[model samples]
Target: MDKDASGPKVVVGVDGSESSYAALRWAVRYAGLVGGTVDAVSVWELPGRYGWSAPAVDMDVDEEEARRRMRQELTDVLGTDAAESVRTHVVHGNPADVLLRAAEGAEVLVVGSRGRGGFARVLLGSVGQHVAQHAGCPVVIVRSGPS
Candidate 1:
C-alpha cells in the first residue's frame, strides 16, 4: 500500500466489533490532528482447523465481503464524509501479521482493545496484544466504552 502523499500515515485494524469501530474513530481523529491519512484495514483468515485438507472456497467472494463490511463499518462509525477520505483495505492473512505489515513506515498503528476472538474478561484482544508488542511504529489501543 502507498503512503499518503500529503502527510504521515495512520494504519488501523478494523473488525466488525464495537471495539474496532471505536478504534477506527480514534484513528481518524488522530490522523486529522496529525495531518495524516488513515488506512483502515480489515483482515480475514481461513479456518486453520481445516489445515491442508480444507474444502474449496471462493476467495474472491470472501475478500469482497470483507471490503463491503469495512465500508459499511466505516460509514457507521465515521459517517460518509470522513469515511470517504480514509483508504480501506480488505486483506486475507493472519490479523496481527497483516496489520503489522500495513503499519510499516506509518506514524502509528491503531487497533481496538479487543477484537472478536478474544475473551471478554481479558484486558486486550490477542491480535491487539500481538501488534502492540510487535508493530514497527507506535501502537494505540483504543478501548471500547462501557457496555
Candidate 2:
C-alpha cells in the first residue's frame, strides 16, 4: 500500500508476461488520470498439483528470481525514466491472494486477463477473477490481445 500519501493508491499485478506488461502500462496511465500511485505487485508460489507425492516446495521459483524478473519487466515496458513512478513488490503466495491483500485499501486494482499460463480468454484470468470477486475496491481486468 502507498499509505504515506493522500492520493489514490492503484495496485496492479505483474507476472513477467506480455499481458502483465499491458496491465502495468494501463495502470500507470490510469494512476496518472486519477492522481494515484501504482503498486506493481508480482507474486510467486509453490507449484500446484505436483505429482509423485511432492511437497509444496518449488526449486525453480525462487523469490529473488521472481523479483528480478518483475523488475526487468517493468524496466522493459516502462523504461527507466517512466518506470520510477511505479513501486514494485515481489511476494511469495498465491497471486490472487497477494493482489487481494494489496487491494485492501486501494482505490483500484488492475490486472491482465491472463498470466503466463492459461488458455486464451477475456475479462477474467483465474487470478483476476479471484481478485475481482473478493477485492475491497474497484477492479479493472485489462485484456491483452486485440479487441
Candidate 3:
C-alpha cells in the first residue's frame, strides 16, 4: 500500500490508443511501487487548418469533449477504483507542450511510443519524441504489447 499520499508524482499522457493504455497501466504500477500519485493528462486542440482554410471552432465544446473523453478513457483503461486514484487533467494545447508542462518537477513523465497520429513504420510519435527530448524530468516511452 502507498504510505505517502504526498509522494512523488507520476505524469502520464493518454490518447485512447493501445500504446497509451499500456503506458497508463505502466504508470499505475510504477506509482504503486514508489508510493506516488498519478497525474493522467490529455490534450486537445483545433487543427491549424481545415485543408484550405480555418474552420469555425468552439473552444468550450472542444474542451468539454476532451475532458469527457479523457475521463472515459481513464475508466476504460484503468477501471473505476484504479482510475479514481489518479488525478486527471484535460488541457488545450499542443500535446507535447502540455505534457511537458504537466511533468514539471514530476518524478517521471510517461507516454506511449506513439499516439493517435503518425506512421506505424516510425518508432516514436512526434509528441513522444518531443517530450523525451525536452521534458525536465525522466521520460518513459512505452510500446504496446502484441494484441
Regions of model 2 farther than 4 Å from truth:
48-54, 58-62, 121-123
In order, the Cα lDDT scores of the candidates are 0.86, 0.82, 0.86
Each candidate structure's TM-score, on Cα atoms with residue i matched to residue i, is 0.89, 0.85, 0.86
Q: Pick the candidate with the highest lDDT.
A: 1
Counting clashing residue pairs in each candidate, in order, gives: 0, 0, 0
Clashing pairs in 3: none
Tens-digit per-residue lDDT, 112-132, candidate 2: 888877676544668878888
TM-score for candidate 1, please give it: 0.89
TM-score of 3: 0.86
Best by TM-score: 1
Tell me the tens digit of each residue's lDDT in model 3 across 1-147. Answer: 122449899999998889999999999999999999998888777765234267656555567777777887888888999988988888777888889888987899999999888587777999999999999999999999976
lDDT of 1: 0.86
Ranking by TM-score: 1, 3, 2
What is the C-alpha local distance difference test score of candidate 2?
0.82
Candidate 3 residue 109 C-alpha distance from true site, Å: 0.1
TM-score of candidate 2 on Cα atoms, chains taken together: 0.85
